[model samples]
Structures are given as structure tokens and as C-alpha cells.
Target: MNRQAQAVVLLLLGGAVIRACFTDLYLNYVKEGLRPFLIAAGVLLVAAAVMTLWYELRPVPRAAATGDGPGQPEARAGGHDDHDHHDHHDDHDHHDHHDGHGHHEPRVGWLLILPVLGLLLVAPPALGSYAAGQAGTALASQQQPSDYPPLPEGDPVRVSVLDYASRALFDKGASIGDRRVQVTGFITAGPDGQPILARMVLSCCAADGRPVKLGMTGNAPAGLADDTWVEVTGRYSDRIGRDAVNDAEIPYLDVESWRQVPAPKQPYE
Candidate 1:
């Protein structure tokens, strides 16, 4: 229909596909978390595309062919609008490209504005550190029988991935240090020749998660792949190292065994 409307429709259709496909990851510079909102935005795009196509395909009524006569516009069997709407412009006749056989659709340019407004006003939320780097990164439901098995009821000093993470970030490993604890994550390389220490990040899926690695030396020499899940059992030593993004060695657990686990269903922090 109009130039602006066509642009809007095409934009919405294209944006939907891009967001859906790439919404898995965000900026590499920032160790971030999975962005569920962007995924939702992508879904919206697909819906907008379908609506645009529908409006374009709808048919509209064409003027009568026999009406070279007096004031008669879209004539029907029963009388409706009695007012003489088309008396002056009776002589004016617009030519149709096709023969009067097929019906024509009015430009549905009006519908395209819906998603355009959404895109402009309310963009999707971004992957933030709050989501991925939080202390409580693991989901309880995703826990397995013994990924980091529940400690036998004894001193009750064993901390868990959920426990350490859920605590205040400023608290460090204060509560669990020198106590038995367990965690699960992917195996990543530690700076220097340090073995045993590895990093594992949890994200919404595998995409938007910030890398939260458990530093343990002398574990796996080959290290681990980019995204491998592992279970480590050790004491929560509060030895501050660096940050996850900066390769900073924050205090990590001493690993007993970094068992490789399957990627859980909800792969997020």
C-alpha cells in the first residue's frame, strides 16, 4: 500500500527470525545471563509476520461495471445508504488492472503499525549479570541423585552449589569455608599451568550464561570443552582469586571429582 507501511512489515518479519535464531547468546565482552525476554520478542515477530500476510491477502469490493449511469455507488439489492454519496464524482472512472473477475484487497498497511510500536516503545530486556552471575545459579529441580550427593547426616557442614550461590555475594565463602561442600558446572581452563581448578557457567540455556567456574587445580589436563557440565565435591575455601569474566581466581572449591553431567533441561543461572 504505502511505502512506510511496506518497510514496517518487512522489518517485523525479518526481525522475528533473527531474534529467534540468535537469541541464544548476547555480547561476548560481558559475561551475561540468558535472556528469556528476547526469546519472547522473537516469538512476537513471527506472529506479526503472519498477520501482515493475512491483511495483504484479504479481498475488497469493486465498483459496479454497469454504472456509467446516475449517482450509484456499490449498488446492492436492498436499499441501505439513501444519501446521494457519489453525485459529483460520477464522471470520474478509475481503471482496474485486472478484469472485474477477481476482487481487490484494500491495502492492509494499518495492521503493520502494531508490532512497529512494540519494537519502538518496549524493546526486549537484555541479558544482565544479575541473572547469570548470581550466587544462586543452580535450579533445585535439576539436581540429580548424586551429582553432588547429599552428605550423610553428620556434622552437616557440606555446602552445595545451590547453597554457596544462594548466599550473599559479599559473604564470600564465609559460611562454607573449611566445610565440606559440592557443586556442578562445566569444566573450563584456569589461567597458568594450574590443574584441578576448572570453571563452569550456568545460563538460561547455553547462550546467555555468565561463566561461574569452580577453581580446582590438577583435575582434568585436557581441561573441558566450552560447555561441559561437571560435579565437584570439596571444601569451600574462601581464597579470593580473580573474577569469572576477567579470569580472576575467586575462591573455588577443592575438587574431589569433576563428574561430567548431562546438560539439564533448564540450562540457565
Candidate 2:
């Protein structure tokens, strides 16, 4: 293929890969082995785009002067192909786009998406006490921390996911002593750009994962936009709730060091 044609293909693939990465339905649809596949796809797309840009800027070969067929279109002496009078390069020439460039209409993936989207775009009660009671499904823990060496006492400590879940559920933040912990995940924020509490999800393994949010509290780190992976370190504090959870069943962390991080392979726990 010509350099221009090749560049176009690369650009198309890159755009499709990016859309697949960002679109929510794409996230959910390609829900298994998505991290690796998406990452690989992204790298390929980037490489393609770079190659395209390079090719686009590259000088084309000097037109071997066949002097233009007497009946054919030819460039003027100064070298800009004057197409002002030409019908050969018509205004309506078809630029067939590849279907692999995964663009889709605004169709909701699941039927419940309409309501979910409404809740997101507008204000809706957060998934709270109502959901707490229903999310009692069994999750298989792949390995226990006991099998690994314990983190030595330092400025910050390593806490188990089990411990974190329990503390959040029962003691809230009151039970934790003066200890700092670090957790990392993709950033998810509110429309107003507050750091919303979030959870990492898994379909089969920790591969095809996306983040579901909990709630946002206090001022978030400046310049940290949603879906940007970050490493957050802070003290876990409890926020007492109203309703059934009013009896202090809420535990969360007060964020401290929120630094951007690269996406990990097994992004979810």
C-alpha cells in the first residue's frame, strides 16, 4: 500500500482501540482478559499512529515528468497540484472506513443502563444501604496473605483486603490505630471532579475489570481526573451514616498522597 493509505489504516486502528478502551460498554463487553488485550491493542494502535504521522510528513517522490497525459490532470509549474478545475478528485469521492474501527451508536448495553445513566448524569441516591444487603454473593479469594511474608512495621503498613473489608463494614474508621496504608486503583470522580470512593470489579478473574464507585468525601487531589490510575495513601476514617447504617457501620480512608501510577496487569483484587 502507499504510505498515505498505510497511515490511514494505522490511524483508524488507533482510534478504534482507544474508543474500545474508554467506552463503558466496551469495557463491559470485552470483560475478560481485557487488561492485557486492551493494553496490547493500545500499544499497537499507538505504534501505528506514530508510523502514520511519520509517513504523512515524509516527502513524496518527485512526479516523474510524463508531462501529464494530454487528456489527464497534471500539476502546475510551482508544484501544487491545482485541482480547482478538476473533477477527477471529486468532492464526493468515497473514503470507505474500516468496520474494525469500533464506533457504535448510543445504545445502552444492558437494559438497566438508561436508569443507571440517569443516576450518573443527574443526582440519584448512591448505591448504599439498599445495595449492602443485596451484595452478599460469595467471592473466592485466590490466595491468603498468611502465605506471604508480613509487611514489617514502617511508616505505612500493608493491610489485607479481608481486613480492609471488615474494618469498613464493622469498626468503620474508629477501630484503626495511627497507621497509614496505601491502595492503588483507577481514579473515578464525580461530575464536579471530586475523588469518589470506588471498588475494582472482576468478571472471571482480575482481568476484565472496571471500577464501580462507592462515594466521594472531602477535597480530592488537584489535577487528578477520573479514570486516571493513582496510588492513594492515607488514614482510614469512618463516616457514620443515617438510616440502617446510621449505627456507625461506615469505614473509609482520608486520602493523603495521591500519585498517578501506571495501570497494573491484574488491576483488581
Candidate 3:
């Protein structure tokens, strides 16, 4: 790409990054901790773009001032005139070739504008039920048995889906006991078309996100479409099922009640 086109791409990309970081949009793609770094990088890119544009658009010095004007030929001393003439002819030939082909920038460079436009115009929603359905439950690696702390003091203690799944699967529901816990997450249909409460956990960003799923049973709501956010109050259960995609274990939850809710500001855990 020409320097001008490159600068425009950089400007758009930087603006997109800054916009994402300034709003809750960044949470859809990355961990909250990376916000500052993203903002800094965006600012740097914008600055670089501005500098590039300035350099490209700046006025060029007149040839007369540099003693290279057409009216002012170089005063050759000694017998170097013949060599200068030959050099000038070679320069003219090189310029003819360069002008004929123009600058050869890869066509692929233009493809970058698509993503920039997507980010600026239509930021994609966070990974939801579709992504969850495509991957196995993320609980397998975390299934190693371990001790868990007791549930917090509340009849319906609010807990994250990840925490509840960890306790139910790895700790064997020892900590959950008979307590009714409230968990919030988007719904993804299980292999049997049952509603499963699931949250995506991001170690860094959405590209590395893994789903933590809890199979819903006992009083669970039905007919809800995928990606519907909900708050579910439930007790732990021993029932488990295998993920259709990878046959990973998905622990069950004996849902007491549930209600539709708005998606959270931060979609990932």
C-alpha cells in the first residue's frame, strides 16, 4: 500500500482500538486487565499514523533552493562531463521503469480495511451459545478432586458459573451441600436439547476462551433460545452428562428457579 493508504488504515485501526477500550466492548474480546495496554497501543498507533501522514503531505523544498533547478545545470570541473551525461541517462531510464510499474504494494494489504470497518461499524457480540456448542465443556482438565471453601452466607448465594461448576465437579459438591446458589450465564442447548447454563472463561482473550457448562435439570425452564442470558437459582446435583462435541463431563444443576436477565457488562469469567 502507498504511505497515504497505510496511514489511513492505521488511523482507523487505532480509532477502533481506542473506542473498544473506552467502552465495555473490549470486555467481549479480552480480559479487563489488558485495557490499559490496549489503550496505550492504540494511542501509539494513532500517533504513528499522524506522523506518517504529516511526513507524506509535507511540502517539498524547491529544486532551485537545492541547486538542482532545470535552469541551473551543475558546473562540471575537469573531464567529468561525459560521465555525468552517462549517469543522467541511466537515471532517466530508471525513472521510466519506476513510473511504468508504479509502486508494487501487495493487494492483500487492502483486506485489512474489512476488519477495521467491522470493528468501527459493527463490533461483534461476545462468544455465546454457538461457540459453547462447538467446543466441549472446559471442566475436564479442572476435574481433579480438590478441597473447596464453604458457600458464602446467603440462602441463595450468588456464585459464578465457573465457581459452581468447579465445586460441583472437582470438589464433589462437598462445599455446596444443600445450599441454593444463584448463577448467571447465557444458555446453550445440550446434546439432548436441554438448557445448559454456561459461561466462557478467558485466560487472556476470546480466542482462547473455554466454556464452563452446567447441565440444567429439575424445574429448569424450557424452550429458551441459545444465548439468552439468565439468572438461575439451583442446588448442586450428582447428575452429569457428556458434551456432544468432545464428550467432556458436564455436571448437572437441580435448578430451583430461573429468570431472563440482561447480559452482563463483562461476558467472560
Please give the CA lDDT of all the candidate structures: 0.46, 0.48, 0.89
What tens-digit string does per-residue lDDT give for candidate 1 at 100-154? Answer: 4334445575776666555445644333333434432232223322223234454
Over 4 Å off, model 3 = 63-74, 77-99, 143-145
Q: How does residue 121 of candidate 3 score in lDDT?
A: 96
**Sort order, lDDT high to low:** 3, 2, 1
Per-residue accuracy of model 2 over 119-181 as CA lDDT, tens digit each: 234433222222333232112222323223333486666554335535554444434556776
lDDT of candidate model 2 versus the reference: 0.48
Total colliding residue pairs, candidate 1: 23
Name the lDDT of candidate 3.
0.89
Off by more than 4 A, model 2: 1-152, 160-165, 190-193, 206-219, 240-250
Tens digits of lDDT, candidate 3, 149-203: 7888988999999899888888889989999999999988889987888999999
